[model samples]
Target: MSETYYLHLNVSRFELSLNGSLGQSVNITNGSDPNAANIYPDISYSLLTVLLLIMIATVAGNGIVLIAFCASRRLKTPFNYYICNLALADFLVGIIAMPGFIVYNLFNEVWPAGTALCTIWMYFDWHMTFESAINLAAVSLDRYWSVRWPVSYKRHTSVKRTILILLATWLYMHIAFFPGYLYDRIVNVYGEHDCFWDLVMNRRFCTAVAVLGYYIPLSVMVFCNWSIGSMVVKRTNATAQDPDVAKKYAEGETRLTLAKDKARRQRQPLITLAMITVCAVICWAPWVIYFTIAPHYPTALPDILITVGYWMCYLNSTINPYLYIATSDDFRGAIRDLFCRRSGQTLSGAFSMIISAAPKRTSLETSVRRAS
Candidate 1:
């Protein structure tokens, strides 16, 4: 996955790695020509364990997001619907993609799962990862639009509109980039026991995949975040100059400290989406670079780096919900409702419990109070 078609969805057979601990490298015929394909043998059990944990986290975290959206009416906004779409993608990656990949990597000798299932795994693995980036872009773009034209955005936005956007995104990703996967399927015939893909033909298609999945989405998110951030700063400054408040502040020495704090706060935007973009760059950029340039350059990046590059995307999925909770009131309230409602811990319930615990006034005390 790392050295070749990104995720190496091209897994045919894993032979002895660089150290050559196994008996010998296995050679397979790519149609007329036979070539030696090396399966990375040093499968770090600790890393695999961590990946398993990430997969679990991805599933649980995204699942919580989905449930939170469903459980609370407060979160039923158009933007939240976009977030829920991303969560659904991350959830699918966890439940369907990660486990399949982890298991595939675990059995380094031969793919126990039938080749047909292997093909399906390959398809889903790329599709889910691509969907995540695309969805993030979509969500960021939606936020930018909402902020840029708040009144119009609110007037036009609806759950139905969000659903349509999501549907379009899903369809576009599937239909536009499908030929790449289909090409791999057609060019690299699967082994009876292995799912190794011959990447010679994939070189042409890898760039397109990288562009659609990584570069374009990355650009979109960055542009959207930048636009929103600029607007936030301008709006904050404009509102802070309110004539009455400015006059009051100008007359007071104590207001100097408050102004400093307010200025610091104003320097930052409310949307922490920039952080998400940073995380995406950290997690996905290496793989994107490799997929785009590796075929032509053939530079051997460290196994650790490659491992981090691919799995870190899963790590992003794991942390996405918590990050949203930090920045989004909707997510926070929805999650609070999800947990509190299930545990019977609503605010009204707390108040009732407090009232019930108070000592009752006796009749004598009541009569004395009345007389007083």
Candidate 2:
């Protein structure tokens, strides 16, 4: 049901031009015409089913995280403030990016929504992706500062400061992705007006975007995690050597118990953040590298690799809420409380149980530490 358009190039001049449906035209040199080959092969029904499932999971999982944040007052701390923002970004990805991608793939890369929607999709795709990356980086920096300088971090990272940081993160991403929004153009590919960035024409700019958006944030995450790991190891060794600290805690010293409880609370969020960072790198690194290098040798890479890489990026947004449930007991409790409230259990009752159980869990953990 789709139309096909072709651009015949003069071999001597090697100029390629596309005439879009609305009479818009685009010119390029030394890049393969997207319509020149079968860039979008017919997808199998089974693969489509799998992709649909992934899309559903992405939407549902992030939605639960957002719901948990909204329903649980206990989750409203500054640390989780960043987490809520991350969930929001991921939720938007599920709401906007994934469905459009499913449609694009379903129709053999034909953008059914026309030029304006294409432009909007491209903008949201890049903007939300960049926003997620910044959020991850922000979470890493927050953890790094909180762990390395708890008192200072607590003093400075107030609710107002967290809001400012979130605002700054969005502003930075908007500025970073503005060029992509501006440069995106629609071209007729096999009779379908496709919206895409003209970055292939300027490989340098594409490389710059990838380096700034992916590599720098990735490097920051790695350093922060390494620093955090080193601090944990040093602190663990110190605690192991210091018998007085263990004795004080065992003897039910109020100050030491409070300190241990504070550390325990901070530890769970750090672990959750670390898991998210690892997942983000794994999911995003492939596409960033592929995109950055693919422009140089566009035909060298297969279409399936591009598709796989793109889906992998989307996969990151889907897994974060699961990571929270897997890593953080408090998050699990909050989610449970949210669901259990319908069964007549109040948040305070659930929290009280959690508070009452903490001492037993702590005692068991302390015993395990001594045994080790």
Scored by TM-score, the top model is 2
Candidate 1's TM-score: 0.73
Candidate 2: lDDT of 82? Answer: 90
For residues 164-228, what per-residue lDDT tens digits would candidate 1 score against the true structure?
99988898788647887888787766566665444445778777777787788889998988888
- Give lDDT for model 2: 0.78
Q: Candidate 1: misplaced stretches above 4 Å?
A: 1-45, 196-199, 244-272, 299-304, 345-372
Q: Candidate 2, which segments miss by more than 4 Å at Cα?
A: 1-43, 186-192, 253-262, 343-372
Alpha-carbon deviation at 12 in model 2, angstroms = 23
Best by lDDT: 2
- lDDT of each prediction vs. the true structure? 0.74, 0.78
lDDT value, candidate 1, whole model = 0.74
Tens-place lDDT per residue, model 2, 198-219, is 5466465676677667777788
The per-candidate count of clashes, in order, stands at 9, 0
